[model samples]
Target: MLLVAPGPFALARTFVFRRYLTLRSHVVRPVAAPPVVDAARKARKLLKKRAKEERLRNFFGWCEGCGAYGSIF
Candidate 1:
């Protein structure tokens, strides 16, 4: 087999390519969520949770002593 060693420019190019590959593989990009968007998401989640709790309370009634929803009688 003929072994031809890479020249300086070829070595540099290989190094740059390897670096690019490494960066591409290792870099983790987070999903972009601005503060306003994040706040709106949190508000929506809170509203949904509150609505669920209200529904459950209406159906099962709230237990004062146990501080939980009462059992279905």
Candidate 2:
């Protein structure tokens, strides 16, 4: 059997090609950020909740002592 020694440039080229293949295989993509809630949408939801509570309080008599709507029979 004959032993063949690889040249310095051959080893360096192999290293560079291996490194390039590894880097190309594993690619990192930019991720999107989480969605944000604007103030107007928050305000609208708050107003809707307040209106619902107000309507419920009106339908059922408000109990100041309990701090909620209470029914009196």
Candidate 3:
């Protein structure tokens, strides 16, 4: 609603208005996995793979040396 009033000067005028605002509920949602978490997961997988390869290498090396060291291969 608006109300207009005339002022003393010919070109001067005042305006009055009323504004009504209604509040409503908003929905909240979950976000996807963070970048840091994904990076950490990838790093963990790579480390595990590297550790497994090292273990296998050590085991084979030990096996190759067993017969020459007077132990069962």
Candidate 4:
């Protein structure tokens, strides 16, 4: 059996490759939504939630005492 160590160029290439991988992994990516976009998203979410509650209220009945929808099924 024969063993050979990596040459200087091979070591440098490996170092650069490892450094590139580290830099790529440590990159900070900002995921920020604009205020207007955030507000619109919240509004859409609220509307969807309200629509779901309304559907449930209509399918069941609004209990005036408990202030919740009555489940018939």
Which candidate should be chosen as best, given TM-score against the real structure? 3
**Model 3: runs farther than 4 Å from truth?**
1-33, 67-73
Query: What is the per-residue lDDT of model 4 for residues 1-73, given as tens digits with 9 covering 90 to 100?
Result: 8899878699789989999998887676554669978998999999999999999887666445345544533
TM-score of each: 0.39, 0.34, 0.44, 0.39
User: Which pairs clash inside model 1?
Assistant: none
TM-score of 4: 0.39
Can you write out model 3's per-residue Cα lDDT over 14-56, one digit (the tens) per residue? 2211111111112234444699779989999999999999999
| Residue 2, model 2, lDDT | 95
- Please report, as a residue range, the 10-residue window in candidate 1 with the lowest summed lDDT: 61-70
Q: What are the per-model C-alpha RMSD values against the true structure?
A: 8.0, 12.2, 17.4, 7.2
Tell me which residue pairs clash in candidate 2. none
Which stretch of 10 consecutive residues in model 4 shows the poorest summed lDDT?
Answer: 64-73
- The alpha-carbon deviation from the true structure for residue 26 of candidate 1, after best TM-score superposition, in angstroms, is 26
Q: Model 2: what TM-score?
A: 0.34
Clashing pairs in 4: none
